[model samples]
Target: MTSSTEPSLYAPREPVFPRRVSGPFRRLKWWIMAVTLGIYYLTPWLRWERGPSLPDQAVLVDLAHRRFYFFWIEIWPHEFYFVAGLLIMAGLGLFLFTSALGRVWCGYACPQTVWTDLFILVERWIEGDRNARVKLWKAKWNLRKWRLRMTKWIVWLLIAMATGGAWVFYFTDAPSLARDLVSFSAHPVAYGTIAVLTATTFVFGGFMREQVCIYMCPWPRIQAAMMDDDTLTVAYRDWRGEPRGKKRDGTTGDCIDCMACVNVCPMGIDIRDGQQMECITCALCIDACDDVMDRIGKPRGLIDYLALSDEPVERAGAAPKPIWKHVLRPRTILYTTLWSLVGVGLLYALFIRSDIGLTVSPVRNPTYVTQSDGSIRNIYDVRLRNQLGEARVFRLSVSSDSLLRIDLQGIPDGSDVTVPADSTHLQRVYVTAGPDDAAASTDVSDLRLWVEDLATGDRASRATTFNGKGN
Candidate 1:
């Protein structure tokens, strides 16, 4: 006898035109969308008051100059550890949020969710709400269908273009780049970036929608690791909802089999099917179910933000514990502490960081040149990094044995070197030991290359070696 077993590895997607919902969660989603999109689109245009030589975009990665400016803060290339710290902090923040509230980031602030919501809003406006959309999707393609489809696509394309266009503005001077873009003179890379982002936003937001969350995104799987039995997640109270369905007396369980929650879900997963990985924990189902419960004169939360640990208590016919009681457990406290410490560490590093630095390289080809009168000279290439927002004069001096002296090659001994602000300046200088004043210790002697801020008297130094004839 032959055994038959067939595997359906993939299933075709069923389009989700989530029905319009009105409740606290829906209202909260709208507010979050406004704030997040506003910040993304408008941030590039915000101006800062950095001095004339600096790009004034409030938040800029000045890659050309190897600097980053965020409001009053400026980061030099050498300070990339600050950037790394910020990235780590962001990762920790995600972990903290995930442990506290499962997939809240996914359902609310994730770009995929926000853009998809906007796209669906546009779709519902053009194609009508869920019921009408379903009918239209099944109907034969007529003029109305073609017209509606075309209109929706065009609007989606505009949104995608705007989204991509805003992103590229962050890389350059926003106003100038925008002008250059409109005149078709912006860099090809900018245009290419915009084009790629626009295509992805259009395809992902308008067509793929929740499929991106279910398949393309890795967060859902990773979040499971962060979550535990006590973590707040959207789930059905099966103890109350089950033993459901219609009876002759019209007295069914609170669920009523209305499918209100399923109909309104963006991911189209029925919460009553138990906690599936597909649920974003958006809690719109809670709103829908509550509304139905109200109409039926029953207590709400047949579907709710449930902690699995509460299952025992609720199934015992007692109320679940308060939300804060679950959220303030030991793991969450530890995560919060770590997040706060990293944040405070970054702040401290920013404030106490040096504003000026010096580095010196001794010329090694002919490390020591014997001057005409039995004196010794060593050529040194010195780089001064001035991190201030304005040009500053610096006095360069040396601290070495009493016999040694400092001489900037082209300047008088007492003259100052004018270093341009927010940049590195290189200078060649000579350290000399006169015939009678040759260093007595050794051929290579330790010395200090000191830079003093002329205006403020702040100072920094680099330790170096002076080549002499003392050996």
Candidate 2:
């Protein structure tokens, strides 16, 4: 039985005081942040010449027009399979990364983590570092503190607003939209989106920081299922650091009970306590521990990223498996293969996709009409899509029995029908078959319609059936 005086297994969580450190990881993080934020803010402004009629924005999701434009590639609402394929590829890529490295995305690449870190940096710049901020929080209200808090809030609001502003640029012609926005002539929906995003960024990045990772994100929950014993995760060298106590002159373990690892953890978790759900595996604690080790004349990596079983075995003088083998395990291989396959398939599909598309729908009201000439006639609604950057002339024809003929009522037969770039044309078409050639009067017979580009000779065909009534 545990006595009242005995220490509880769980200690009250102490707020992290994370001192800034610079290393390879820190440099990589900085570069990633710069690239990601640059792309986010600037991508919508990039222009692609897609003719005068089409939107010039390189990547725009024109939901109102039921179209998506990405540089040279345009996707119609009917081609949602591309979007699905993209999503699948992204998922498989995530799985592959998780299986190989474990939580690197959470630590460095997650938007929440990145934004929260940026907000924290702003707070630190305004209010000073951990100890200073702590002291200010404890002190009574004063003019200096008030001014600092106000400045921090103003900066946060500016950042959040910029984030929102950049997001709105993606949906419209960026330069024109920017001009409209500056003139206050933009849509109210744009303003509403900016307001919502600003509020969320300010609240989540500034206040809800670690809470988002710990409680709100589903990634952490799903990560558990994806991770294995062999996966490399941010971990403490418990075998070497344990029997933890203050260092002596000659006899001692590596740890000096300085709690540097705990103090520098962004999520305020103690690495020495072993892995927990709250750990983002940021490796700031590794930097902290390394600093402490240098100061105490001990080797670094007391708390480091390592495989759980391997670290213990190493401490006990046992050989461990190669890191390569662990990373290239069965699950990782499967995810990698799937990711590659999907990526290749998407690339192939994109390269082979046609600039013209044609779809035909049979008129439902009267499936077939018995003409005065004792022939069968069928009416169809044909939709012609021009996915190119210029208007196209397409010739429509019917192919079935030699006696079958296509008639365009309002338009001339074999005449060039013009379709504007990135636009769809809906036209009424009729197909007629002589009674002698109409294979079966009692049954529906298959008929094919061909739509060909007059200049390029590119063509698309759709099949429909002409219904006939029995005598």
User: What do the candidate models score in CA lDDT, each in turn?
Assistant: 0.88, 0.83
| Residues 364-394 of candidate 1: C-alpha lDDT, one tens digit per residue | 8787888778778888999888988899999
Any idea how many clashes model 1 has?
0
Against the true structure, candidate 2 reaches a TM-score of 0.93
Strongest candidate by lDDT: 1
Residue 289 alpha-carbon offset, candidate 2, angstroms: 1.4
lDDT per residue for candidate 2 within 379-434, as digits (tens), equals 89998988887889999988775467788767874546889877899988887777
Specify the poorest-scoring 10-residue window by lDDT in model 1. 246-255
Count clashes in each candidate, considering only residues at least 3 apart in sequence or on different chains. Answer: 0, 0
- Can you tell me which runs of candidate 1 are displaced by over 4 Å? 1-5, 248-251, 363-367, 412-415, 435-444, 467-470
Candidate 1: lDDT of 311? Answer: 95
Q: Estimated TM-score per prediction? A: 0.93, 0.93
